[model samples]
Target: MKKTVRLILPVLAALTLAQAAQATTPSRVVQGTTELEGEVAKLGETFTLGKQSPLNFTLLKVEYSVGHVVIGNTVYSPKAAEKLLLLHFAVHNPQRRDVRYYWPDLKFTAVDAQDRNHPYAQAVARDGTTERLEINLKPAQKVNVLTVIRVPAGGGVPKLLVQREAALLRYDLRGQVQPLPKAVADPTDTSGATPLTQVPAALKTFNPLERFDVRLDDVKFTGEALNGKAPAAGQRYLSAVFTLRNMEPGGGRYAWSDFKPMLRDADGERVEYNGLLLKASRDETAGGTLGAGEEVRVRFFFALPANVNGQTLTLADGTGRAYVYDVSGVR
Candidate 1:
C-alpha cells in the first residue's frame, strides 16, 4: 500500500501542475486594435477600451484626477510627488454560475516619458472610488469598476501596462485625463428603497459608508432551527441570508468583521451572532477583499430563545453606516 501511494502521489502532482500551466495561458480581447502577443504593451499601442475579451470581460473607460479627488462623499488627496488615476471599466461575467472577479489582483504599471516604470500605488484611495480585493459575482452580472492608481507627480502617464491573469494589455494614457463634472445623485434615490435591479447603473455611491459601498437586496429567514443539523436545548437558530454588493471600483479589501452585525429585540436589546452558530456556518461568514463588481450572498445565523420575538438585524459597514432589516416576519 505504501509503495502504491508513493507512486500515485507523483503522478497526481504532475497532473496538478499541468492543469495549472494550462489555466494560466493568456487570452485575447476581440476589440483591441493592436494585440501584442506578449504581456507588455509598450507606448503607441492602440488597444480597444470597451471590447469584450475572450476571457469574458471588458474595460469600459478610463479617467484620471489630480490633487484632491472627490468620489462619492470621500476625498482622496495625493502626496507631494504623486497623482491619482481613475480607470473606469465594466467587467462582465457571461458564465452560468458565480465567478470571482478580483480587480486589485490585476497588475497595473505606469510608464513615464523616459521609459521608467512606476508600480501601482501600494495604498488604494479611500472610499468607493477604490476597488475591492475580491468580488464574487452571480451569473451574467456586469459590474461597473472604478480603479484609482497613484503615479509620480510630474511625468505624464503616457502608457499604462495592465496585466490581467496571464495576458498583458497596454493602453496609451496620453491626453486621457478628462475633468470630472459634478457628482450627480441617482434619480432612483427618491424611490426610498435601495434598488437591486442587478443593472450596473443601479450601483451608485451609498452615503455614510465611507470605505465600502453596499446595499441589502433581499433577506430570507428559515424558521426551522437548522437545515442540516439539530438545535441546542431551549435555543432556536435563525438564519438571515443577505445579498451584498461591494461598490468600490478599484477593488481593495473588505471583511466580514468590517460589516459589524448585530441583532436587536423588540425592547431595543442588542445581541450578536452566536459564536457556535458562526462556527457551524463558516462558509456563510467568510470574509476577505471583495473585488469591484462582485456580489456575495452572506448568511448570518443567530441562536435565540425559542419564545423571543420581534427582532431586527442591523448590519454596518466599517464606516458605521448601517442598515436595519426587520425579522418580525419570521415570528
Candidate 2:
C-alpha cells in the first residue's frame, strides 16, 4: 500500500510539468487573445522550455506576404507616365495596443534606362482591405494590413522594393522591410551583407514589376535630400530628385500626376519603391524641393550600417496616365 501511494505522487508531478510545457503555443482553448513568448529550452533526457521577459504589449505579431507587381502597356509622356508595379502585402498585427509610433522615412528605389539607382513614391494599400488594418487595442486584437506598390518597374533594374515595413525603439528607427531579389552571382549578399545573415532589407513581394512607356530625354532628374531615415528597415537618409529640364522649358512640366519611382541593380531586381513620398526636415537643413522646367542636380545623402543591408542611390517616376519620351544618356 505504501509503495503504490508513492508511485501515484510521482505520476502526478510529471503530469503538472507536461501541462506547463504545452502552454507556449496558441491553442484552441486560447481563442480570445494569443500571446507569443521567446523561450529557451535545454535538451537532456527530457527538454524544458524556459520563458524569458515579454516584449511591449504594443506588439503581438507582425506577419505579412507579398503577391505580385502588375505591368501596364499605357504610355504617359516623358517623366510623367505610369510604371505601375503592384506590391501585394499582408501584415497581421495581433496585439491589443493602439500603437502610436512615429513613422520611419522609407523609399523604393530602382535603376532607370541609364542604369542608375533612382527612387520613387511611397505606396499604400486600398482602404478597408484586410491588409489595411490600423486599430487601437482592447486587450485582445488581430488585424491584417496590405500595401499595394505601384512604382517604376523596368529592365536592367537590379532590384525593387514593392512594399516596406518599419520598426523602432527608444525614438530611433530599429529595422525595416522592403521587396528585393538576390543577384544570381551573389544571390545571398546585399551590397556586402551575408546571405545567411537575416539583415533586414525590404519586404519580399510575390508580384513582379510591370513595364510601361513614358518620355525619357526631354525629362531629367535632380536629386533631393532629407533628414529622417527611410521608414523601412535600416535606413539612414533619403535622397530624391525632381525634374531638371524639359526641352521646351515649361512645355510639359505639369502634364502628369501620381509620379512613382524605383531602384534596380545591374541584374534587374527592384530594391525599393516610393509613391507620393516626401523627405524629412531638421530646422536648418529642412527638406529640399524641386520646380518644374528647372534643370539642376539635387541630392540628399543617407547611410546604412556597414554590416547590415544598405541603401544605394536610384530613381524613377510616372503619372499613372499616357506618356512618351526620347531619353539621352547621363553618366
Candidate 3:
C-alpha cells in the first residue's frame, strides 16, 4: 500500500509543476476591444489601429524606474508605491496627405499585475519637451514618441492598452524591460563648422514648372549682407539666378510660386528661406506671363546658418516632381 501511494504522489507533483509553468509563460495572443474583434499582437510588433486609419504603431522598447526620471532639464517622480514606466514607440503616417493627431485621440492605459489600470502621465517631444503632445505628420513620415505612465511598484510585467475610435490594441511588455539609454546629442547641430565637399561648376537645367524649361545661370554665396542690410547673428544669405523660358506654343502664366525652391546642407537638413531679405532686395523675381520662346532671368535667395555650407538645391513643381542641383562649390 505504501509503494502505491508514493507513485500517485509523484504523478500529482509533476502535474502541478506543469500548470504553474504554463501560467507564467507569456501569451502572444490577447483579446481586443469590441471594435477590433480579431486583432492580436505581441510586444515589439507593429500593428495598425484599423483598416480606415492610415496610422501605424510599433512598440520598440519599454523601461521602468523606481527612482526619478529625467527628461531634458526636468525630473519627474512617481507617487508613493508607484514606478514610472517609459514606453518608446514610433508613430508612422503612410498616406500622401498630411495627418494631424493629438494625444487624446488615442486613449492609453497601463495594466499592472494586479489588473489595476493607470492612465498616461505625460509625453515627451523630440526636443525633450514634456508639453502638449501634438504632431503633424507629412506623407511617409514617421516620428518616435515617448510616453510615460505610472504603475504600481513591484508589479510584474505590465501591458500597454491603446484605443483609437473603433479599434483597440494591446501589447504585453513581458521580459522586455531595458535600462534607460543615455541622452543622445542632436544630429542636426552644425556648430562644428565642418567644410562641405566642393562640386565642380556645371550648367544644370530643370523643367520644374508646367510648360517651362529653366536653366541654372549662376549660384552665388552672398555673405551676411543683402542690400547693405545684414541678417541677424548666425545667419547668411545665398542667391541663385535661373533663366526660365516658356516652352508652350501659346503664352503661359509663370510665377515664383510655381517652383518651390528648397536649399539643403551637406547633411540634407533644410536651410530656411529669408523672406525679409528677399523683400528688401531688388533682385527678387516677380510673377508674370511669358509668350512662347520668351526667356526671363529670376533670382531667388535663401537663408542658411552661418556655420553651414549649402550643398544642394531642390526644386519641386506643382505636381510634386522634384529636381536636385549641386551647389556645394558656390562661394
Candidate 4:
C-alpha cells in the first residue's frame, strides 16, 4: 500500500505542474478598441466614420523606424532625424452598391507632440501596389490599407486626426507604435536576375475584362524596320500577338489598349509600349465592337534596349489584377 501511494502522489504532482504551465502560456492577441465616439480612440479599436454611407475602420497596428522601409520590391527611407510610420488598418463598406473612397478623402492628418500637423505621404497595398486617391469597394467589401507618414524622430506619441463634415475624429497612438523589424529576403527578389516562370506555349486564356478572353499566340523580336516603321538607334522592336474574343451576349467594346501592357525584364527593368507603332500597325482588331462569339487577332509593339533579354510581358486590368507572359525566347 505504501509503494502504490508514493507512485500515485508523484503522478498527481506532475499533472498539476503541467496544467499550470499551460495556463500561463500566452495566446494570440486580439485587436479591438475601447473608445467611444468624439473621444480619442486608441490602437486596436474600431472607429466609425461617414454619415449616410457609413464605414467601420480599425487601426490594427503601427510600425515606426528611422531606417529604410520596404514596400513590395521598393525601399523607402526617411531623412535625417525623421522616421517613417506605417499605419495598417482595415476598412469595410456596408452599403448595397459599390462605394468609392480613399485615404485622402478622409482628410487624415497626423498631429505630433509639438502640435505640428503632417499629411499622409502615400498609401500602398500589402503587395506594394500604390493605392490611388480613389478606389471602388463592392458592397460589404473589406480591405486592408497601409498608409505611410513621416514624423520627427523625437516626436512624442502622435495622434491621428480625421476631419469629417460634422465632427472630427481623433485616435491616440500612445504605446501602440513598435519598432520596424528587419525586412526578410524575398524569394522572388530579382537582384540576382532570377528568371520568371516560362508560360507554356499551349493556349492559356486570360479573362482580364468582363465577358472578354485573351490569349497569347506569338512573340517576335527584330532589329529591322517593321512595315516601313523603324525603331530608334540602339533599340529593337518586340511584337506580341494575341487573340481577343467577346463572350458577352450583347456586343461589347474590346481594345488592346485596355490591357495596359508593359514589359519587365528579369532584373526588374520596365519598358513601355510604343503608341505610334501600335497606331501605325493599323490592326483592325486593335479597337472595335465584338459581337457574341466573335474573336479578333491583335498585335502590340514595344521598343526595348537592344541588349535586353529574358523579359516578361505584363497585362493588367484596371481592377488591379495582372497577367504575366514569359518572353525569354524573344532574344
Candidate 5:
C-alpha cells in the first residue's frame, strides 16, 4: 500500500500544476481602447457572466493591471447579466522566499449613523494558518486568487462594499507598486454618496410606512466615495446599509431558505433584484431562524439617480409595512 500511494502522489502533483497553469494570466494589461469583454461590466453599463456564476459559487482570479478585486454577485438588478464587474488585481511575488496572505472572509456587518461597528454578520469564516492563509508564492512569480461572492435573492445588502483596512493584500513587489498605490474610493465610486451619520436617518426617517419593524434594535448605513459626482439634476444611483433586530418575529424555529429583497425605483418601479452590498439568498436565511432579540445588518446600494427616485422600502412581511425617508440629491 505504501508503494502504491507513493506512485499516485507524483501524478497528483502534476495534475494540480496543470490546473494552475490553465488559470494563469486571467487578464492582460495592454495599452488600447477602453473595452471590457465577456460578462465583465462597468458602472452605467449592461453585461453578462455567461453560465459561470452558479448559485452560491465563488470565483477567483489574478490580474496584472489592477491589484485586488472584490465584486459581489448581490449588486445586480434583473437587467444585469450574470457576470457584472470583473475586477483585476495586479500581484507580484518578487522574493526568493515564498509568502502567502489571506483575504479576510466577507461578512454581513452592520454600521450605525456614526460609522460605528454594528454586530450581526453572515455566518462565514476564513481558514488561515496564523496571521494569514497559506498561499505558496514562488520567487518572482505571481497569481490571482479568484473567489466568488454569491447572492441568491434576499440574503444581501442593497450594495456590497469592498475595502481594505491596512493594505490587507500584501504586495511583495518590494516597493515597485509605490506610484500605483492602493485603490481608494473617491467621488467616482458609488460609496461616497452619503456619510455614516445618515444611516439612522435613512432608517428612521425613511420608515414612514413602517416597512421595517420596531423589533430592530440595530440599524446603520455606510457611505461611498463619490469621485464621479452625479449631476445635481440628472438621475443618480444610490444605496445604504441596514441592521435588523429580532427580525422574522412570531415564527417557530425559523430559517430563510427562500428570502429575497424587494427594490423599486423613484416612480414606484420595482426592480427584480437578487441581492446587493452584502448579498441576499435563501441560505442567508438558512441554518436557523431569527430569535426574539437577535439583530442583523446589511448594506443597501442601488440605482436611485437624481431623476428616477424611490421613496419607500418594504420587507416581504404579511403586514405589508413600508419605510419611507427623505433622500439626498434630486428625484
Candidate 6:
C-alpha cells in the first residue's frame, strides 16, 4: 500500500507542474497591443505606457486629455474648438544621428471600447503653446511631444494602435480627459527680399538648379501637336517636359504643387492658362506619387501672347527660393 501511494503522489506532482506552466505561458500577439517586457528592438513587442522601457528609446510617460479647452496652469487648446483627444508622450533619442519626429509618419490610430477607430486629429494651437509634432532631435535628446486626435463626446478607455517598422505598440488611455481651446491662424508676412526678376542669357535643354531631383528638359515651341486645335484670338501654346528621378532607395513623393509655375512674358506681365485640354496638355505632375528609382515624364502647357518674343518660366518653392528658366526662342 505504501509503494502504491508513493507512485500516485509523483503523478499528482507532475500534473500540478504542467498546469502551472500553462497558466503562466505568454501569448505572442502581433500588430494589436499587449503587455511587453525587457529588450524588444527585434522582438516587436507591445509596451504599456510609462511601464516597460523601450530598447530603442525609453517611453517615459503617457498622458491623455479630452474636450476642446484643457485649462489648468496653462491652456492646452487646438483650433476649431472641436472635441479632441490628446496623447502626450515622452520619448528619448538614443541614436547617434539626429532623428526627425514627424506625426504623419508615426501613423497613430485610436480605438474606443465601442470598436470605433479615431484617426489622428489635425489641430493648430491658438497661442502656439503646443509644439508641432515635427521635432529634430540630436543624439541622446529627450523630448515630450503630444498628438491631438478628434474623438467623440464620451468614449470609454481609448486604445491606440502604433506601428513602427513592422512592430506594433498599443497604448490605452488611463488618465484624465481635459478641454482645449480654438486654434488661431499664424500670420503671413511678405517682408523678405524680392525674387530675381531676370531670365538667364545662356539657356540649355535642361537646367541643373533643381532642389528635388527633378529636371526641366525638352522645352521648345511646337504647333505640330496642336492637331488643328486653334489657340485663342492672340494666344499660342508652349510645351515643356519635366523629368523626375528618385534619388533615394525608397519611393519619393513628388507633386506639381511643389513647383508653383508662373510665366512672365517679355512685358513682365503674368500669363494664365488657356484651358487647353489637348492630349499632351495634361500636367503630368498632377495627382501622381513618384516611385523610388523611377523616372517620370510630365508635360505642361502654357498659353501666351503670340507676339511674345522671350518668356520666363518662374518656378518658386514658396520660400523665396526661385529658379527662372529662359524659354525664349525655343525651336
In model 3, which runs have C-alpha deviations exceeding 4 angstroms?
Answer: 1-38, 67-75, 122-124, 127-132, 179-331
List candidate 2 segments past 4 Å from native: 1-81, 94-96, 100-120, 126-134, 137-142, 146-150, 156-158, 161-331
What value of lDDT does candidate 1 attain over all alpha carbons? 0.53
Assess each prediction's global lDDT (C-alpha) against the native. Answer: 0.53, 0.29, 0.63, 0.62, 0.32, 0.49
Worst 10 residues of 2 by lDDT: 41-50
Instruction: Give model 2 RMSD, 1 decimal.
Output: 21.9
Candidate 5 CA-lDDT value: 0.32
Q: Give the poorly placed runs of model 5, Cα more than 4 Å off.
A: 1-202, 205-237, 247-261, 276-291, 304-307, 318-320, 324-331
Question: Candidate 4: misplaced stretches above 4 Å?
Answer: 1-37, 67-76, 122-134, 180-331
What is the RMSD, in Å, between candidate 5 and the native fold over all Cα?
26.6
Residues 304-329 of candidate 5 have per-residue lDDT tens digits of: 45546554444433222223343423
The reply for model 6, stretches above 4 Å from the true place, is: 1-211, 224-230, 272-287
Error of 4 at 158 (Å): 3.3
Query: What tens digits encode model 6's per-residue C-alpha lDDT throughout 38-135?
Result: 22221123233222222143233333332232221223332222234555555565667776656543555667668688777543221224434466
Task: Give the per-residue Cα lDDT of candidate 1 at 226.
Answer: 53
Q: Candidate 1: list runs displaced more than 4 Å.
A: 1-36, 39-55, 67-76, 121-133, 179-331
Better of 1 and 4 by lDDT: 4
Per-candidate TM-score against the hidden true structure: 0.35, 0.22, 0.40, 0.40, 0.24, 0.34
lDDT of 3 by residue, 193-256 (tens): 1111121224564442335666777777776456456766787777777778765555677775
Residue pairs that clash (backbone atoms under 3 angstroms), model 6: 66-177, 66-178, 68-179, 68-180, 69-179, 69-180, 70-179, 70-180, 77-181, 79-183
Question: Model 4: which residue pairs collide?
Answer: 32-44, 33-45
Q: Model 4: what TM-score?
A: 0.40
